[model samples]
Target: MSSFVTPKKWLTVPLEDVILRIVGGGTPSKSKPEYYQGEIPWMSVKDMNKHVLQDTVDHISQAAVDNSSTNVIPAEIPIIATRMGLGKIVIADFDSAINQDLKALFLPTEVHRDYFVYWYRSVAQKIERMGTGTTVKGIRLEVLKGLEFALPPLAEQRVIADKLDTLLAQVENTKARLEHISQILKRFRQSVLAAAVSGRLTEGWRSGDNPERNFKNLGEAGVEVKTGPFGSALHKSDYVNGGIPVINPMHISEGTIKPSESMTISHQKYTSLEAWHLRKGDVVVGRRGEMGRASVVESDEPQLCGTGSMILRVGEDALPKYLEIILRSPTAVSYFNSDSVGSTMVNLNQKIIKNFEVYFPSLSEQTEIVRRIDQLFAHADRTEQQVNNALAHVNNLTQSILAKAFRGELTEQWRKDNPALISEENSAEALLERIKAERAAAKPVKKTRKKAPS
Candidate 1:
């Protein structure tokens, strides 16, 4: 196996040499509910998500520990997953019992705890790739022990760990802030929609005309609601590779129609189901499943609405874009959800769509409202895109930092500045010799059997 190439003063050693002991864990009898009721945290693969695990989802009793192969690992020790969650590592905050999938490593005093943890994290992906099993993949003990470890002097190890701690923590904080911004952008878009449909967004434009804000049912304001074809009307055999696209509920997202080519129908089928043909300026909506999913058709594309959707043809009194915004608003969604039929899957009928009340503004006012809402929404979309890009960069920055730390690039200056720490007596080779001597001294001597019959 290839070994890790370290600096001249550093040493590359087998992982087993640095570790004092490797302890495997086990699960208590799950049949006995009493075994799980105690205060000791029982760690499994699920609890290994965080870098520093404080508590677990389960707890086990002392009786369970005595009855099972599981062992308690003390706080601040490094625990890694050998199965399922292959590459993860965590330090326990309290003394915790581990299930069969985890292994707790006991290191010598000479090895920096944080340094080992960071190094393990750097090679986690490599370890994961070494895992083997038909079902739950796991790394064998031999494979783990045989793995190479790049060792620097103890002092340099500590310095590298300290630098990583500061850098990675800053990266995490920046990511958290970016995530918070993404959430804010979501709320901002929803707020814009809420204001647009409520007539509040167009209040300024309405000042000169003071036209009567008529509240009328959708049908009264001139909108014809038509449901799509039934299942019997469209068959699977009618679908063709290059045919008219079908607009399904899944295709309608964020006020736009994204037709699926695979769900398309042949020209013959489209001609037979001509009543469901989509027209430009028509607002298509999902009639089943999630409510308030809608989009306005902006093109004269030869597309047929799927069985799970409905069409809203707005008259001159209402703009199609404005109607789409109204249907997708929170107020309309709440109404549809409460009034919709079916216990397993909710559905909307033509009557429900036509009877829904809407804030009817003048045709000119509807145009202005749609324009303002679109402008605001576009701005929010751009901001969200930028935030997503930044989040991607921040995520990559973590691995980049870890790679640099392991390559000795992070402590290059410190190594040059403090040559004594990495030279002769304080070198990595000397550290390994010290570890070897300690292990030999700690070995227990076996007692010789005396001659009983003599």
Candidate 2:
């Protein structure tokens, strides 16, 4: 067991001594259809991950409980999984029954339930070590009963739980704000890309000699877009271990190449589909999934376009980076959204990509627009990094608060202020003895059956 520094006036004892009862639940027979048709919630380990469970994935009839080993657990009791999902704990928010893997601890009046929940979270790692199994690890009942820990007096436990609850709520609020800021950053980036692709971003540069009439369709500017080979032409079985790299929809993301699962095709397969090959300065667009998502090909070596992607070869009039930005922008994305076909999963093809008109200025103006977009994006990136760091710090603060709260550091001043709650009889050791005595007094004596005629 993990060691803890018990504070003055506090005491450590076996877990069972502080609780009224430790009970295990069981499932109704699966073969009996009538047993599972009622309204009682039957919770498995999956339902125990949340702090409070209002309902379960499955419900069983009351007849199921009468015929099976399962017991109905009242609301407010904390339940922990002793089997497969070891250490996960939650409080029952409604009257419920649990499966065999769960153990419910019925707290005595002196112990606070939420405080125990937080305490269990702190020592969950130790409980995990007590479990034994090769395939599905589980904790034996005796080991669970013998686990030891220190806790503050009742009044102090309430105070500590309240403080931690308030502080943790603030941390969660901060995290929610950070996540909202990240979403705003994404929309801002798309807006910048949209403005860059259209002439609106660099409209200030339109002067006496330069006009906005230079916009042209992608195909009119000598750019050709071609989709990869059709479905029947190349099968997944044709892919080999090491050969020419085949870029798929997974490879194109966020205007960059990020291959989800690296794939290659043999030289013979590559030879048949040489028309769909990719080259340096070529723009690759995802044709099957996530329409309009594009990336620039930076490698000089030969690569083939996989079944769900397309390659765009542009002439000297347009830079590959400039067109790549346009393809990823919301302006191009709007076209893809409207033109994409397929009821379930929308798909893109070369015909739709080639005909899309692109507005542009001279090559020099395009370069300036790219530079301006990059500068603004770099600032946003720095802000996003700071937000992420703040989120990490907030999470770390939660753990630190729990550690201090468990060690009596959080309520150290409270203890000094209220000396009466820290007396000898009110300590955890005395509370344990009272619980044991009550349990013994409440036990029923076994009646001996008289022998029959001998």
TM-score of each: 0.82, 0.85
Task: List, residue by residue over 1-454, the lDDT tens digit for candidate 2.
Answer: 4477868767777787777778889989999998888999998987866777778989999999999999889888898999987777898779899889998888777788888888887777777887899999999888888877665788888988898889778877988999999999999999999888878788877665676546677788777888778768888888777678888988777877765334888788888887887888889888876776788999887788878888888788778888888889998888888988888887886677777887866788888888988898899999999988998998787777778888889888988998877777876667666767877765667899999989
How far in Å is the alpha carbon of 293 misplaced in model 1?
2.5
Q: Candidate 1 — number of clashing residue pairs?
A: 0
- Counting clashing residue pairs in each candidate, in order, gives 0, 0
lDDT of 1: 0.89
Error of 1 at 415 (Å): 2.0
Query: Where does candidate 2 stray beyond 4 Å?
Result: 24-42, 45-49, 53-72, 83-85, 125-146, 207-217, 230-233, 238-245, 260-262, 265-273, 301-303, 438-454
Candidate 1: RMSD over Cα atoms? 4.0
Cα-based lDDT for every prediction:
0.89, 0.82
* Model 1, residue 132: C-alpha shift (Å): 4.3
Model 1 clashing residue pairs (backbone): none
